[model samples]
Target: MHDSRAVPFVCPIDHGVLEAHGDWLVCVQCAQRYPVVGGKPVLLNEANSVFRIADYTGGNAYGGASAYGTAGDGSRGLKRLYHRIVYTLSESGAGPAAPFSASDAVAAVQAADPDAQILIIGAGETSYAGNITYTDVAFGKNVRCIADAHDLPFADGSFDLVVACAVLEHVADPARCVAEMWRVLKSDGRAYAETPFLQPVHMREYDFTRFTFLGHRRLFRFFDQIEAGISSGPGMSIAFVLRTTLANSTEHRALGAVLHLAGLVLSYPLRLLDHIFTRSNGAYDSASAHYFFGQKRETAIPDRDILQFYRGA
Candidate 1:
């Protein structure tokens, strides 16, 4: 089904239209044939995609590469499973919910045009909405194709709605990624994104940067702001920082994982405190994450004027 839905994908490197060739999407301009895995096209610009589950798993279905005598993929099966369990139990994650929440994003696209062709960036981990078409660097649980945020695989002005939740911090260059998102959107299309601010290093070395309150606005300078505010407040920030500090401070990562999970039991209760602090004036200073809901505009935001949007210098 997803293979059939992937008819409009283009090449991220050259923007060439792609046609389905057997189990692959072949680019017309470059003749680059991308393989389809599990009905989802793998359209990553790089042959070795970091998000590909197979790459990390060392060819195992359970993703336990340590058992296979591998260490370069960033995580062993036990470590990966440890993080997943902690995240699930604590309910602290970068998905389309809390901290980097998805409310504004889901609301904007659905409200503006429910039937619009929507492209969801970093959709391998979770689904943004039932009406969305998902894409990521590799086919995961629900992704429709392989796409990188820094270079999209869709044509210019091809989409009516674009949603990227908790994805910017993972990309090497946040500004270029946002620009790519703006590029794929129609003149009247809308974009919704969220990123962490006070969280600790996640996804290991892949976690590159954290933005201040104003930094998020400047990232989407080309779009008209519809709503921009804290999704996860100071309390959750305290929880995340505490738990991660405990987990990463020690040399023994497996022990650290257990320590962090135990610590999360205390932190999980702190989520409720977010209800109070999210409305505070200084939420920007300590909030865990922020969301940006904006509409695309033909005119780009002048570079010099971007400084004016800076909330913290």
Candidate 2:
């Protein structure tokens, strides 16, 4: 269980301090609940039916986790280089900032101004915390981490910047999620969001959809300035295709365990190839993810639209 005093964030659905309950976290507010097995929150009930939670819990992540084949030492190497090469390639495609190191982008903003108030949406355990690792030691204490994403608990225009990573894909309505982010952001604030484009079925506890680069651009149209691009090289696509093919085999259920083990071994060599072939900038034909940064333009408030207002005014 997390030490509440240390984290202090409440659940978005229930607004209660998340308390550990039988391998899950139960909220006292709405009583809406989720699991925390393996130290990762199981945010969606739907995941229980579609995924093998037991397999995930047993350290058989190669079979049960997202990107089923990228768990072993060998596969991990390949996956890392795959992301590195792809991200490097994406930097050359478009935008002010380079595509490499979201950690750097995040750190750059935090370091530029000491008083910059920031918001982290879908404040999951890993990605958010991981970003903080690269943050300058000077600004670490000033940041706030909120656990809720669906309905941000803060007042509107409360922050100078907002960051969301790999989050919209898990929400029921990506459009609504984008709207909420826009709502909380100060008129002058900028927001950064990143998500996968073509990847495996892992992170499916609440996984809803993936975006094409163009689709991401459409989603962020509200912003005055938006830059959308992809991440990871072609090797990731190769890995996805191979595993997906195996997963659909007629005898999959029977041979899944063996195949998963085999995948771990294969992932290493594939990762090496990724480094060789994907080291330079090229068109994102094989980009596995997408990211965008947008600056809010001062505009009329959206929620107070004509539909809800009196026509006589």
Candidate 3:
């Protein structure tokens, strides 16, 4: 169970301590005013981020309606059905097993300190046990607060473990986001990240970047790596490419959806090949996604040392 009182909120601009005053949190140092929406603070740096605090407080975030449809509109079921279809198509083949268990990492941190404060960036619908704080750019049922990765609204060294799975690719400035992750973590605190390498864009405008295995490792050079390797292998890459290409071939939404499904059905079997390909060193070059788990260090790993860590053929 996450306790909201464990971590103190801070102003995104000056990292000043915030005190609640009516429906707003006023910074003690900078006196910046941030709104509290539905009991959750909308602590965003408006100048630096694309999102404005008014977007949430004024209810214009999703244009006064949910993007995925609402229960009252009767489109919730359709939205769910659409997601199911997409999942069915994308999960056709046997994909590579994740290199590390996120649950295991949580357990490890908890073992050392049962009350360890954990932060999950881009948490989406995922939930974890213990003192966890869930944050995302968009508000959701699971999200405790709305925050931007580029400028996190927490005091320095506030968290014991920071998880950013499937998030780096969406940020405009991944390096800056990683730096913020590093900033929020306590000294020697652990950090985990999973990023796509060969997968095609899915978030449309939100998707901006990808990283190879070594590149992903280099991104967190400020931390000493605990483990780093392919989370999804070349097989997933092939499946996604085929699906995207076929889907983009037709302008009609219905036809494109059908083509996408067909592509998955035709290419799913190839995904099993990941089991074989992942065993080879060359798989690093063509992996669909990679994960890195590291502990924060005062000094960054040298670039020359990072180059020597490459394993691709």
lDDT scores of the candidates, listed in order: 0.71, 0.51, 0.84
Instruction: Show pairs that collide, candidate 3.
Output: none
What are the C-alpha RMSDs, in order, of all predicted structures? 5.7, 10.9, 3.0
Question: What are the per-model numbers of colliding residue pairs?
Answer: 1, 4, 0
Residue range 131-231, candidate 1, lDDT tens digits: 56777654456667667787788889988778887789888888888888888888888888878899987766667899887778888888997777777
User: Can you rank all candidates by lDDT, best first?
Assistant: 3, 1, 2
The candidate 1 region of ten consecutive residues with least summed lDDT is 61-70
Answer with 2 or 3, whichever has the higher lDDT.
3
Better of 1 and 2 by lDDT: 1
Candidate 3 residue lDDT tens string, 1-313: 5444667778989999899999999999989999899888999998888788888988776321123323323445865676566675665448767768567678888898888999989876668878898888777666777888988999999999999988899888999999999999999799999899999987678788999888898999999988888888998899889989998998999889788878877778768889898999998999999888899999989999998778888
Alpha-carbon RMSD, candidate 3: 3.0
Give model 3's TM-score versus the native structure.
Answer: 0.91
Instruction: Tell me the spans in candidate 3 whose CA falls farther than 4 Å from its real position.
Output: 1-5, 62-82, 91-93
**Residue 131: error of model 2 in Å?**
12
